[model samples]
Target: MGWLKMPLREGVAALQNSIVSELQRNWPALVTLTPDLLGLEYPGETTLDFLEAIRDLTDSGMVTCEAIIISSNDGPRMVDAALTARGRAMFEPKGRAAA
Candidate 1:
């Protein structure tokens, strides 16, 4: 896929979007997704990239995620993820009140 060849900036953006969309698809449920799971979706990204994207989304308040340290080599990685209020707002149709 073209995403596999996308530049770092575009790829990271796509990763972040994918993260949010996955949570959105599941809605109110907290989903546990390891790096391996994410890798299946974006074969182009490294584990580090997925960790960074999770941090970015969490820092931005778009999503609430928990980072689990698998080992020294793995460092801190996000596992459980769910959209925050801000994140849910992104999917809301224009002119509709947020639930």
Candidate 2:
């Protein structure tokens, strides 16, 4: 059980890292937070998993989400997000590393 849990945790962490890195690379673009959009950005990741990663990023304050009503049938939902200052800093080259 413990071994199974370890792999699962590692996989999730990897997915999260991938999502963050992709967002950082695509900085300044208003990325839709939907599973389909994320899947397009990161294929091989299930919609549920991508949604979970987006939730984690939002909770961590690394991104800002905006609610939008897409249609009459659909209610207002968090549809788009953009990286925050902290997230942008992630890609900044370090003092010596930049040289």
Candidate 3:
């Protein structure tokens, strides 16, 4: 998929902002890909992209995501903040078949 490219450092920040919190733990429960259940347009894709980008930050002690969850007051929304070795973050959408 076409993604907005940036830098590794930015990817790290993006992942942290998207998943990591001030829990002060070595590992996280899971990436917990946030989703809008109401079904928006690109929120889910944007969130999943970050989840896929996890490959980029794995070496940096970043946490990995498990199952993706979708939820939205108005529409289902899920966004990924996974990091990519290409030194950037991306939005990896779930398979269209599942949609």
Q: What are the models' TM-scores? A: 0.67, 0.54, 0.29
User: What is the C-alpha lDDT profile of model 3 across 1-99, one tens digit per residue?
Assistant: 866655544344555444433211212221233322212244545454443444444435343333334445522222333333222222223442210
Runs of candidate 2 with Cα error greater than 4 angstroms are: 1-10, 40-45, 68-78, 91-99
Lowest lDDT 10-residue stretch of candidate 2: 1-10
Model 1 gets an lDDT of 0.68
Model 2 scores what on Cα lDDT?
Answer: 0.55
Please estimate how well model 3 matches the true structure, expressed as its whole-model Cα lDDT: 0.36
- Evaluate all candidate structures by whole-model CA lDDT and list the values in order: 0.68, 0.55, 0.36
lDDT of 1 by residue, 4-96 (tens): 432445467777877877887787888876666555433334666776677677777888866555455544446677888997897566897
* Highest lDDT model number: 1
For candidate 2, report its TM-score. Answer: 0.54
Q: How much is 89 displaced in model 2, in angstroms?
A: 1.8
